[model samples]
Target: MSYVITQTCCNDASCVAVCPVNCIHPSPDEPEFATAEMLHIDPKTCIDCGACADACPVEAILPDDKLDPSQMRFAEINAAWYEDHPAPEGWKPLVPTPAPPRDRGTLRVAIVGAGPAACYAAQELLERSEVEVEMFDRLPTPFGLVRAGVAPDHPGTKAVTESFEWSFRREEFALHLATEVGRDITHAELLEHHHAVIYATGASSDRRLGVAGEDLPGSHAATEFVAWYNGHPDYADRTFDLSGERAVIVGNGNVALDVARILTMDVDELARTDIADHALTALRKSNIREVVLLGRRGPAQAAYSNPEFLALGDLTGVDVVVDDADLELDPVSARAVEEDAATALRVRLASEYAGRPVRPGHRRIVFRYLAAPSELLGDDHVTGVR
Candidate 1:
């Protein structure tokens, strides 16, 4: 049996460079490399060498025999990509990179955020003998998005945070929680102690809707919604008005999908994850039954990856709907699917969703294309969306 790439794969192609057998699809040289969501390994060609698993930054690859029950589905998912063509023989092996000499003197580096990027940076520096790394975060916790942004139901994806724990336990690393660069500490102070400073502070603020009535009680940024559910201290006191039956999200991106999923997910399922207590209570009482995702472009131009789009289909007790009128691609989009593998996959899935009969489900998500929010339609609170 071969290894499988799971949902945590971010399409960085790090595995492709290390694979000796060239079993991974959508290599860096391919046009679809940019458009593809995740790389797949041909089961027949993969020699079960485990090189790809070792090289994956997110720890998304797992040997078929060792897969957790939740991730067993990926074995078939990976094999399906190369079903038509048979595997070839004579695979090359990968040579591991040797650690550099420890002649260099102790070098101190400061990283401003404890997000995925910063943790990876700390991991790389800790690989060297003489490096001392300091990670600082204002929230008093590490693993930024893994702790605060990822949906609670996505336990498999969130498990990637465990890889960072390895770096945190290293003797060469120190974690400074509840510290702010401009508040608790000064830039000059860090420069005096550390040789280099790295800022991995992720997008902390949300992009504003920039329309009238945006400040209404019912309206909110998708970022806050995600943070609130994930138990971010800053948004712990915040609340969303879920009394309304219908909710409209102005974007078709992954974050938008996350918020929609949280709003509509089964309260029992969410209870199994690490979602905040307050958020779980609020979600249980939520009256929302319909979520409309408005995209400025057609279905072919969706901003989310194929995996995210496919997950919507797999969601239980939720009906996924795509208007047939919204799926009619123009000439430019038609050519894009022909040339881009990712676009082709997204369009194909969305097209299939359009044909699916709208069975009665507890909640429904409607994907509407070629529409942009002009203004929020409400008086004191959001009564409706225009």
Candidate 2:
């Protein structure tokens, strides 16, 4: 039997690199990847070799026979993707990258920030016969976003860090943690010690929406909220005002959905994961019963990935609220939805949620489309949103 990709797929595409038959659709190089909800495996071409399953960080792939009742539907989902995408037309000859000249001799490299890119770069460099690597990070911890940015409940996604262990174990590799580069070491010093320096420091700040009251005390960026909940040292002391019954997030992207989920999730379930004590305590005391995500575009143009949108519906005691009005797209968008499988799936999923009854007494996440925040309401703290 072939392997099927399930709802938990994180879209990290770790499995794509390991698939021997190249059955995974929307590999990072493909145009579909940017809009793809989740990567799909082509069952017709799958060898059932289990290599993709082994490499999948979130354990999203399972053989058809091994799938439980809840996941059995994914078998058809996998097959359906191939109906539209089909098998890759033909195999291309493998082109090997040329090795550095022998005279280059015992290559030494310095990598700044121990994030996924740095670790992966170290791995690739260490694979060369004479290469040696030294990795440095300002923070004491490693795996930048994997440790501090990923939602704690999604531990399976964090397991991708295991692949980086080899870089630490290599005799030619060195790691320097809790050492700031500008203060502890200079760019000239890095150049003096290594052949090249690669900076992998991930984005640390959030993009502002530039509304008038955005600078008010109650308003906060999605990145800050994520870091606060994930226990990043920089934000462990941070706090949020949870006394309000309804919270409004300005965007419809993954982070906005994540913020909504974290706000509405059962505190007990959150406790089982590694959420920060401070944030969890606040959640337990939260009076927030509704989280409204505002999007400037229609449902077809919503920014969330399909897997995340699907997971939101599965949360216990939470209702994904969608208005029927948002699902009706204009003629141009309607045509795009019909032609693009990814966009069509997003609209179909939103329509399903729109048709579902909002259970009484369940906490709600309302999807508000074709709406943008003109200004945050209130003089001191947020009292309402316009």
Candidate 3:
């Protein structure tokens, strides 16, 4: 069976860059790519090598025969997209050129953070001879976001680390784990050893929710929760109180969905993944049954990608809920969706989700729109959200 791009495709364009035959549509270079609902694979031109599937961050691609009943429509959708949009003439596959030789003496570069951005830089640097790249991360592990930010269940997306690791295989590249820039070594000191320093220290902190009672014991930033589950050393010992029956997440982005999914997923299924042991133990005992995702704007204004929003419907035991009222778009948002393809896809999926029948499930995720929390309810701890 030919491979197809499903609803969970995050539109990250990682797949398009890797396709050898250039069968994927709405590639970053195309005019319509900005508004595309989800990427489509031309089944006729697809080699069925599964390269796109491996590149997908959310595990959204699947073989035609392997697609779930609901996802079977995507196969047709993928094929139909090609009918009007033929492959461009003279399109060639991308191949990396070998780095030219450097006649100069050894040049040293210091890269801060061992994340994807930093590793990509190292890769380019190591392509040339007489160049040495030293990568530094505060944590002991490399591939910062791949190891800590990505959800445990989406291992396919995490597979990009394999390519990052190839940079380490070069003799001129060295990784310094558990090394702090300010405390262990100063920028001035780095300049003394290396010609230049590149800081890729990934966003280390979360933007404040800035609501009253946010300082309550139960009120925690999404980053704290993500870091705890991913087993970041600084957050490894942290604990979450899942004593409440309903949990409220203040944002509607992909990270919010990831946190909500982890909370409602089957503990047994999570056990099979690489979630932190402490988080797994706490989750097994959690009483949280309802997760409310609060978005300040209408569905058309959602910051989440279509694939991430659509994936909520496919969770095994979670009933995804969206109020019809929340989906009713204003004139401005409707016009915006008309002009922007990404927003159009998000609004389309949200509308579809709102009309679906509620299924019997152990947990529920309620998406609330146009509702902003002015304050977190509680005296000593966050008991409710306003």
Question: Candidate 2, residues 1-386: lDDT per residue as tens digits?
Answer: 79999877877787887887888987877888886778899988888999989888678899999988767767877787787788786544334568777786898999999988788899888877789999999998998988888888888778778888878999999999999889999999999988899989977877888888999988999888999999889989888999989999998988898899999999999999988898988899999999999999888888997667867888899999999988878998899887876677789889999999999999999999999999888989988889
| Pairs of colliding residues, candidate 2 | none
Looking at candidate 3, the ten consecutive residues that score lowest on lDDT are 89-98
Candidate 2 positional error at 75, Å: 3.1
Whole-structure CA lDDT of model 3: 0.84
Question: lDDT for every model?
Answer: 0.84, 0.87, 0.84
- What is the TM-score of candidate 3? 0.87
Question: For residues 1-386, what per-residue lDDT tens digits would candidate 1 score against the true structure?
Answer: 88899877877677987888888876766665676678899987888999988877677899989877656667766776565334445554445467666776798999999988898889888877789999999888888988898888777677667777788888889999999999999989999999999999888877887888898988988888888999999899998888889999999999888888988888899899899999999999999999999998888888877667777877778889998887778999999988755566679889988998887755999898899888898889987777
* Clash number by candidate, in order: 0, 0, 1
Candidate 2: regions farther than 4 A off: 8-14, 68-73, 89-94
Highest lDDT against the true fold, candidate: 2
Q: Per-residue CA lDDT of candidate 3, range 234-336, in tens?
A: 8998988999899999988889999999999889999999998999999999999999999888888876766677777878888888888887778999898
Question: Which segments of model 1 are wrong by more than 4 Å?
Answer: 12-20, 25-35, 49-59, 62-104
